[model samples]
Every structure is written in structure tokens, then in C-alpha cells.
Target: MIYYFSGTGNSLHVARQFADRLCEQLSPIVNPVLTHDKSIGLVFPVYSWGIPSVVDNFIRRFFQSAEVRSETPPAYVYALMTCGDDVGYADRVLDNALLSASGRKFDAVFSVQMPNTYVCLPGFDVDSDELCKAKLNRVQARVSEIAELVAARRKDVRRLKRGIFPFAKTYVVRPLFNRFLVTDKYFHVDASKCVSCGRCRKSCPVGNILLIPTTGGQGAEVKEVPKWMSHCSGCLACYHSCPHHAINFGNMTAAKGQYSIMKQLHG
Candidate 1:
């Protein structure tokens, strides 16, 4: 089985390609969630140099549960992750999770670079179409190499040691990061350009942003909206999916470009 978690489509796209290569069942960890203890593979994006909190919690619970024991344990497993930068100990996070659960080890691990769309965070930049295409090609090559290694039973794996930063970020830096940095970058509704159509609010997956009545309440509402940041996945789905293009990622992101992987696998 292949287990995947994705806020945007980057990791999902990779997982889908991996499933196609292996001819295995693909299961999502979120959005119609499922549980699996059988021989498995994990695919996701590296968030803050480690697994996302939701994914970590899922593994912690999966191993601690009694139902997982009756199934065939994973004799061979692999981990694949995509990141905007070098993956620092992200594979170790997954390795440790599996190790704690059943002493199972990863047969192979891989990381690839995808376009960074999480404009909600500081220093995050949107990739141009040209850059995205080039990186996607590189990632596809690496992924294909990983698939070959999996088929060959090459057990060249590394231990995850960069736990200090991940732990500190997950426990300490994350709270402040969410509280301070998560606003005004994910999606911004342009009041002057917006027609109060509620297109952006409806398009938001997390519903953190909504349309509210203006002070005068003339047509509908212009700018009064909730600023909840905890629920955001930084996918930019709201920004791209909006019909009016009124939703943006602020001025710095106004000129920023975007890209996506349409083909399941690249040749």
C-alpha cells in the first residue's frame, strides 16, 4: 500500500506516479482517511524540514493501535518526499516512526525538489513556469531511480539525525510561526477589485477566510473577514482557483508565477 499526505498536489502527484509504477493501492492519510499496517510506502512533502504534525500524529496513533497488528507487516518499505529545499532529516522522521512501531526499516528513501507554493511563510517564493518545469524533470529522474532501487532491494538507507530543529520547530517555533507568519500571504482578497462575489471564500479549502459585510453594508461586504491562520494548508488553491483573480498572495506574489504537473510520470 502507498500512504500519502498532501495539502497541495505536489506530494499527491508524486504519490500517484509511485502508485502507477508499483501497481499498488494508493491511500490518502487525510480527506477520507484510511489506516494500513501492511507492507507499505509513504510519500509526502517535507514541511519545515520534517513530517507535518498531522502525518506524525497519524503514524504515532497507527503504531499504537491494536488493529494494525493482525495484518502482514511491511517487510520492505520505501519513503519518498518532495521539498522546496534540501530535506534535512525528513526521512529520519518517517524512519523513526516506523522503527518505534514494529522495528521495521525503510529499504529505500528519496527526496525531490518541487516548486514552492507555500507563500504564506516568510522567504517562500513562487516558481516561474520555466523553473518549475526544469525542476519537475529533475524530480522525475530521481523518482524513477528510486523505483529502480526498490525493485532491486538495495538497502542503502541513512539514519535521520537532524531531529533538533524539527523538534524545536514542531513544538516551539510552529506555534509562533502560525501565530505571526501565517497571515496576509496565503490568500488576500482585493476589496477594490472584488465584487463581493464570495468566489474566494468558497474556493478556500480550509475556510479560514470568509466574506463579511462592510461597515455600510451596501452591496454585500468588502473587507470584514475572519483571519484564522491555523487552518490554512498554504496550498494556494484559493489563490489560483479564484475566478475573478481578486484573491492574491500580496504584492510580492502578484507578479509571481505558478506551475503544476499534469502528466502522472515524466519520460
Candidate 2:
């Protein structure tokens, strides 16, 4: 069985590819399900040079559940992490999380470069059309190779792309990012530009957005705008999926480009 957590479709697309190649069933990490499969695979996006909180929490819960702890044969655990550029010791971080929760680390870990979607800070934005195309073009072959290795039950595989200064990025910057930038409070929607569409709410994988109807023009126009809740996956899906680009993360995303993997693939 393969468990996955995707925000804007990158991880989901990659998970689907692996599931097709390996003939495994895919389940969202947020959903609760019990399985005794010998091979357990996890696919998720790397966030803030580490695992997203939602994914982390799910991993803990999934392993500690009464149904999962009593399994007989050990599972061949592995992980596939998708990142914009690099993962920076994220595999180690995930291994540690799994070790702490279930007393066993991932036997194999892989990282794949996906299109850039993080744009909440200065000097960081979505990739250009050429770069996005280049990344997408390579994902299939990479995922295929990974699936072949995984199908062979390859152990001790650590194929990953950890860019320079990995320790600093994972240990130092990740903590700060989790503390400061992972909240939904910074999300802003331009009421004037909003078309009263529910796409923002739909874009959120965790259902952390709400649309409230209010009188806009002389109490005649009831416009529905997005309001964020406390629980956020920090995926920036709301910012990327808005048709009119009305959503912004604080003020940093005002000029950033919006890249959607589904739109890039299908449209």
C-alpha cells in the first residue's frame, strides 16, 4: 500500500505514477485505513526543507494505531519526496520521524524535483515556463526508475537530491520556517479582484478555507471571499489556484507567479 499527501498535485501525480508501475493502491495520508501489506510506501512533498506537519502527524498516527502495531511480517518501508529544487536532509528527518514512531526507519528514500510552488517569501517564486516544463518532462523517467528499484525490493537505497548546505537548511532554517511561516494567518484575498468563486476552498487539501458571504456594494452585492482557518498544510495551494490571482501570502506573493501542476499537465 502507498500513502500520500499532496497539496497542489505534484506529489499526487508522482504517487499515481508509482502506483501504476508497482501495482499498489494509493491512499491519502489524511484518511484512516488499516492495511497489512508487506511493502509500505510514503509519498509526499518536502516542505520547509523537512516534512510537513500534517504528514508528520499522519505518520505518527498511522504507525501507532492499534491495528498497525500488531502486524506480523515487517513492511518494506520507503519514501518518495518531491521538492522544487532540493530536499536538504529531509530523508534523514523523515527516517527519524518513522524511527521514533515505529522503531524502524525507511529502507529506501528517493527525491524528485518537481515544479516550484513555494512563493511566500522574497527572492522565492514559482518556476518559469521553461523550467517547469523541463522538470515535468523528467519526472516520468525518474519515477519509472524509482518504481523499478522499489519493485525489486531494493534495500539501502538513498537516491536523493540534497543541495549544498543540507545540514544548515534542514536543521536551522527548517525550524524557523515551521515556527514563523507555516501558519495560515498571513493569507490575504483581494476582495476587489475576487470573483466569489469557491476554487480557493477547493484547492486546500485539508479543507482549511471558508467562504463567507457579505454585502459589498451598497448592501446589494453579496460577494463571497476566502477566509483561512488555523489548520493549514502550508502548501500555498490557495495562492496558486486562484483564477484571478486574488490571493496573496501576506504581501510577499503579490508579484510572484502561480504554477499549478495540473494546469501545466492538462491545460
* Strongest candidate by lDDT: 2
Which 10 successive residues of model 2 have the least lDDT summed? 213-222
All models: lDDT? 0.63, 0.90
Task: Please give, for residues 9-126, the per-residue lDDT of candidate 2 as tens digits.
Answer: 9999999999998999998888746587899999999997899988889888788776677777777889999999999999988988888888888889999999988998888989
How many clashes in each structure? 1, 0
lDDT (C-alpha) at residue 40 in model 1: 63
> 158-177 in candidate 1: lDDT tens per residue?
42324346556555665575
Evaluated against the true structure, the overall lDDT of model 1 is 0.63
TM-score of 2: 0.97
Note the residue pairs that clash in candidate 2.
none
User: Which portions of model 1 show Cα errors greater than 4 Å?
Assistant: 32-37, 70-75, 99-107, 153-156, 159-188, 191-216, 220-230, 243-245, 248-267
Error of 1 at 166 (Å): 9.6
For residue 165, model 1's alpha carbon misses the true position, in angstroms, by 10
Lowest-scoring 10 consecutive residues by lDDT in candidate 1?
258-267
Off by over 4 Å in 2: none
